[model samples]
Target: MTLVLKAMALTCLVLLLLQNAPGVGAQMYPDFKLQQPQSSVVVIKGDTLTLNCTLSGSGPVGAVKWVKGSGSDNQTVYEQKGSFPRVMRAVSAPSNDFTIRISNVSLEDAGTYYCVKFRKGIVDDVVFRKGGGTEVSVHARPSVPVVSGPSHRAVPGQSVPFTCSAKEFSPRDIKVKWLKNSTLVRAEPPHITPELSNSSYRMSSTVQVKLSEDDVRSELTCKVQHRTLAAPLRKTYALHQALRVPPSVSVVAAPSGAVEVNKTVNFTCRVQGFYPGAVTVSWLENGTVMNAGSSTQPTETSRGLFELNDTVTVQAGEEKSGSRFTCLVVHEDQEPISGTGILRVTAPALGENNEGLIGDSSDILLSSPGLWLGLLLDKALLAVILFFLFKRILP
Candidate 1:
């Protein structure tokens, strides 16, 4: 019975040794030292940042975890105690560098950040870190204002009204100024573009000035300043207007006939429809200005609407062919208007067996049988008369 008890004790010992063997054969874990992180504070609602953690000597880290410690239960930031919330990446070289990325940071995110590595249920290393902080200063985009003032280009003392405004982004106290050649112009009651964006933004500006062609031609600018934006804003436009003028020239053909060869015809051109109308009028034969043919007598229109003077009458023979006549008009602005009309000379007809005479001009008609019979009767009568004359003249 004692021998049986010894065998049972030996078996128990063997079982205990087998359980301890795996744990004892494990390699010794090398210790890691975490270098302290650089300290920094950031402004709120502003730039984003990343925290970098460095350490000395790398160990066989089963898992690297990130965590944030609070009073009660340590809140897990990137890793739970035994497992990694993320896979830890390491450089193949001997040095250790771990960087965490943070985006669009706010003030509340400020606190202690840590990076810890673990191996075989042993704590390898711990690193303390902090991301930059921010001071909350919220602002919005500024307003767009209207441009106004005297409607045209300003002269020396014309007091051209120049105006701009920002009605939208209000209560932000917008300031406006005028700029010329990139330099600010001093004037009473400056201007600016206000926050056109909703109340979320700040905006303001204004510009009122008296200017001229020189001022308008020079680069004109409206400057806006706001508390929120980093720099001033501006807008610009050219001052110009399109003006209208009166009517142009008039052309007419006289005697209104198709002039055949050797026929005489006439032409006339006068300045007609217009306002504060034409000051001078003349006709052009082809390109030659007909200044010699001026009529001093002015004829009033039957409608009596305007005074029509300077009738240019030209006597043209049929030899004048393919002649172009134009009436020229010069107005108050010395603005000139010209219009053209073509002259045509008729040509005579052409035919065979033709005579210079226009009547019965064909030889075929003169050679007809009826015409020959009439000619023979006349010849017979003339021959009888000649015989009678011989009879009388022989005695």
Candidate 2:
């Protein structure tokens, strides 16, 4: 009877202890619960972040704190003693709300966060409960794109290189493209590199273009696309900035072939297929600079090149016969290009009674031998008749 009573008392003490223990009481009451409503969150850089947490039930409770990461990599984010500068409790103390707010969040702040319940023990605080972690994903927008081209001017049929670059962006997923005059241009694949300084990424894209005369007014665009951008970013560069095409020069006379003396002649200088429309034209006579000629404004061609025409008028005089007329074209700080035309002059004919008549008779006699012999025979016959008449008259 004594052994039986001792065993029963020991079993009663064990039951009392189990009912008062925190972990056992939590399971027995079934009212203790912790909840993290958000399983994951995404926030942009420089924006505020909110981590939701709630506690309920009338079970044993203790101080609450927010912890980031897990295991050996864990770090205390917020607690009753102290917290980081950018981190704080969302609700005031003495309440069931254990939500947290982080202001001015950066890329470094991205991680999983947990709302933890801790109980004060004899030696140290012990973890009583933990809510499901909230995964934080921070995103950073890429910088504006910058476009560049070759330093020297490019000509038709030449290949030139152009570059477009962007930096300081998070997440390696990015796209870059090139365009000319709103049309897509084939280019090399984008080169992505890690920026160790800020733990971000940078990208560059290059394209090789075979130039044509039509590119003088063309525009090149660099377009960038990323997950953080609502619309693609674009930067434009004018092709004319690096294009240079020389003009083809020619000189033509109004009459074409040859012109008589004292005749009015028109000399035209044609400047075609040149870029950067600004040009000057001058005329020269026998290596001497003549008066400024009339020039038409540079006109744009179908191929986007420029053309101009300049005219100079002069009288063709006897002294100006065999004279040379030159057309000089100066375009875009380049040396002069020249084209030349020659003038031919002839004197007016004289009347029949003048020295011109005597020269014509001599030419006819020299050219017709049969006619000269007939005239000589007629003269000899007339002389013989005169001699016979003189002899008869004298006898």
Candidate 3:
């Protein structure tokens, strides 16, 4: 009987404990949820980025502490509260009042971030901001870095600042990163600029890196990253005191510069020796234009290393002599130079020549109708002379 009474008392005690556990269930740290933006978008370098996060439920923010994995305790990246930023005790009025503002974010700032709430000895509510998640990207293009000492080569321990810039983009989710031999160079503050409002910016950076022979010998790339694209943009370049880029060109042929009648003989024009490479060639027959596909290009450049190629076949008895084939090179700030070659078409057969001569002789004979009139004038003069001589002899 005593054991039954003890068991009944233990059951009542267990029910009381369950009822008092409300604090553990109510004040529990809700799974920190972030709302507002469905996707994280990235853009080219030199663009601004803003991330807006919202709460699932409505309540006072109470106290909010924002922290980043990359930012150290001393260097607080972003804050919008009073003193003691480590503990931001602000009231979040509405669900829409939750947001984080990041300006001109860079690669170093790329990491997870958090928003949490805490009360003394009590587990208060918390909100969270996850990784930047590629919200911005920098489209870094291939460029030649500003080399102070020498662009060609530099020794180790030499302080060389590789300066490059990227233009702004939409949604502004771009990142610029420096690399040496495909390895990242770590440093404090990895210098970055702030995002501007209502306008895009051109972000420039001078990476003070130690230059070794390896940096001078081969190709280097200045890479730009952004969330807009699946791959990062890269600009490839080489450092050399001497510029090694060469000029290139193509050839064109003229219409009517073929083996048919009323067409001149074919010709070619070629231009070479340029840098950073943009070259075009054209064919000119007596200063007229010709395009490609008119003639086949040689596997190797012909003499004078012309930019274009043009040739015309001769038809039977086609007059092609005295026609000119010219090649021209096109470039900025440079006059187009042309080379000319002569063409000659053989004359027609002898019968055709005789017919042409007869037609010309008929025209000449008809033109001088006065020849018959001159003969009649001479006959009249002879009759008058004979009559006068007979009268003089009879007297």
Where does the lowest 10-residue lDDT sum fall in candidate 3? 299-308
Q: Which ten residues in a row have the lowest lDDT in candidate 2?
A: 348-357
lDDT of 2 by residue, 153-259 (tens): 88789999999999988888899989998899999789999998776899999998888888888999999999989999999989988788889999998987667
Off by over 4 Å in 2: 1-30, 37-39, 59-63, 69-95, 101-104, 118-127, 181-184, 286-291, 317-319, 334-336, 349-395
Structural similarity to truth (TM-score) of each candidate: 0.30, 0.71, 0.26
| C-alpha positional error of residue 380 in candidate 3 after TM-score superposition, expressed in Å | 75
lDDT of 1 at 116: 59
- How far off is residue 246 in model 2, in Å? 2.4
**lDDT for each residue of candidate 3 in 1-395, tens digit (9 for 90 to 100):** 99999999999778545433545423454554445452444434434445455555433344544555444352343444545322322334433344555544444444345544333322433222333322333333322223222354343446655665665433344566666567775433323454464233445555666644334344445666654556766664554332222234433344333343444433444445333233445666567765542444333232212232434332323544565656665544356655565555554446753654565665766777787688789999999999999999996
Clashes of each: 32, 0, 37
lDDT (C-alpha) at residue 34 in model 2: 84
Which lDDT tens digits does candidate 1 get at residues 91-198?
332346655545554434555655655443323332222223122233333555555545432333354456665544423565777776677877565433333432
Best first by lDDT, ranked = 2, 1, 3
If both were scored by lDDT, which would come out higher, candidate 1 or candidate 2? 2
